[model samples]
Target: MNPYFARSRNDRLAVGTFLFGTLLAVWYLMCVVLPHYQLSSDYVIYAHYATMTILYFQSLANFVMVTVARPDGNCKALQRNQQTESAHCDACGIVKPPRSHHCKVCDVCVLKRDHHCWFAGCCVGLRNHRHFVVMLTYLWLAAVYGNVLQWTFVGDQLGGHGPATWFRIVAPHVALLTGHVTAYQFFVAVMTFVGLLCLVMFSWLLQMQVVQIYHGQTQHERETAVTKYDLGWRQNVTCALGSRWYLVWISPWIPSPIPDDGYEYRTSAKTD
Candidate 1:
């Protein structure tokens, strides 16, 4: 009912749509156009198809998890006494859990709040942190893969035996499709540029997330110099990625159970 919540939801929906649509378009390009032009070997073509399929579905699952999985934000259940100082949020008038911070955009407290991602149009917090990291990882991989494939295809078209010019390569595809350089080819050209940019950006993001997880810190916690939640590297990674983390990259469908409930977490001081 709140305007802030409404605006945040709308932004999330719009961004999510854009992201999902972009990925779907890339999948179509890779599965449909790529194999026809780039590969002569059946094995390579089939492998490309399989790669695109996994990336598409995994990306979709990650996007869904990031969008729908919200923190409970109910601090009252954890608070045994009304007078507890850390138990109350002044803004939302709810009990605040440890490591939770109030997100102005979402208008609620988020458990283990990392950062409010404008691209995701949501707060990166407890329940969806794993999903967020996995999304970035897969998206980066997809971008890198797309860039390499596009580069090779463009090079072959441009009369170069290896990587070569952009316009000289793309102009033929555009002209063949519509007798002249049409919007479709232009769109592909733009995506080629975007793919490279995303490859670099997401690579940096994934690296940052890995470093943060290794040190058992969220973006907020790192800024605030809070290390109470640092539970050693392995346990910290396990906490973020869940139990079956090794298989998380292969597929989002794989069961990777988060150890904590978001409301309750084990700090460095406690063993149990």
Candidate 2:
């Protein structure tokens, strides 16, 4: 019996696959179903906005949850102590690089370890964090914007009725948009959905910008122990989303690469 199979590798693959499937299912339902049958305009709009907010919150929550390490104490102090070139992770038994954390489930030290995402069915580590973010941005907008478009179709289907019969006529359009869709139109539907998704994600990304301006923290700084926020907001943004978030799509946030042997495990030092 191979020990690696019984350890992190198998669990990671299984759990990761489950998460990926779940996200795919959700994407199908949100982007495909509701839009096909023509759900309510308000519902579609609300879902879009809600998804945007939720993604932002989820990203923030996931980042904070994993990187903070000991959420109870002065993480600042622990980080300060780790200022030397390298250190070990007590949990996963590896010497983590400067901004790395050990993931117990994956049983490896993930560089720039954000939270493990069930949506992508992968750890939001250095390798795929950007992809996951891009996916979220796409999914959120696809849900909301797509729904709004559906409402337009529903309205068109109804041919613009007046106040009295508007409610009655519009209600059916909503129902029709909600279900009975197939995979073929997915590409066409995704075009519209992706556009809206990008718009909303960009807007929220800007919002994260404004918040960071006042608080003076990057996504990376907020998550890890690299606390030199004095280097202007531009640098902070660059560090957070890479030097090119404003330029391209699809998880442009690039993380620093991890070392060859990976992080060392340090015994949790008992503080008196």
Candidate 3:
């Protein structure tokens, strides 16, 4: 009930709305409006339209899941006299299970706490980590797809005019918003730039997540050099991504069963 926790949650909701709206707007303009306007002969725009829509909704659904799913903190059930090894959370005056850590921003201890993500406006902990990862994967795909489509549209615009014509079109728009270009053209150019930026940023984040899964480490554990839960690669992946791991990327609605209840985890003695 900390004020900051409430503020962070609100911040994440706003971010989610902005992200979803921007992506959807760009996809609509690029995949539908531009193709129809140009009387595009290529059939790929039709296919891209469907694919982009799927990716957009899938990403948005998972984003909502991650935002709403709260971490399993030190609850009353775990607080009772249990033999399981646990730590005391002074802030909440409760017993925290192994691997759980206190989130200062959330003002609560989270099970398998990774980190608080400002973008998602939630703690990336046991309950929502899979959703977070899947969301990123889909969003990254959307960005890549948008970039390709927009680039192709730019090429079509410049056809027979040569590369130099890009400046001729964009330079006038920059100064006076008057040019040989339509509004759709300006939109495509802006979306292409944004897509490239997202691609680079998300690519690095996705790679880091993959590495952490492979090594059986959370962001917090990686920082601490702790690898007690260093199960084999397959187990580690299932632990984080759930049983239906292969289908997680395809859609967010798929049921991905986490192997163990968040309270209990199988660990190895080795620390890497």
Which lDDT values do the candidates have, in the order given? 0.71, 0.44, 0.73
Among all candidates shown, the one with the greatest TM-score: 3
Q: Which stretches of candidate 3 lie over 4 Å from their true place?
A: 1-6, 9-17, 24-33, 36-43, 81-85, 155-189
Q: Per-residue lDDT of 104-183 in model 3, one digit per residue for the tens? A: 77777787888887777768888889999998898788777766655655666544346554553446356226555567
Which one is best on lDDT?
3
User: Candidate 2 lDDT, tens digit per residue, 1-272?
Assistant: 11212244655575465445435534644565456555568876576557645554454343332332231122333344444566766874444465566556545555555555433333554444434445455445544544454555434443443552244333433333654222333333443344444457556764554554333343555544334433455543344444464642522333432221112322222221
Worst 10 residues of 3 by lDDT: 1-10
Best to worst by TM-score, what's the order?
3, 1, 2
Local distance difference test, candidate 3 = 0.73
> Can you give the TM-score per candidate against the true fold?
0.78, 0.42, 0.79
Backbone clash pairs for candidate 3 read: none
Worst 10 residues of 2 by lDDT: 259-268
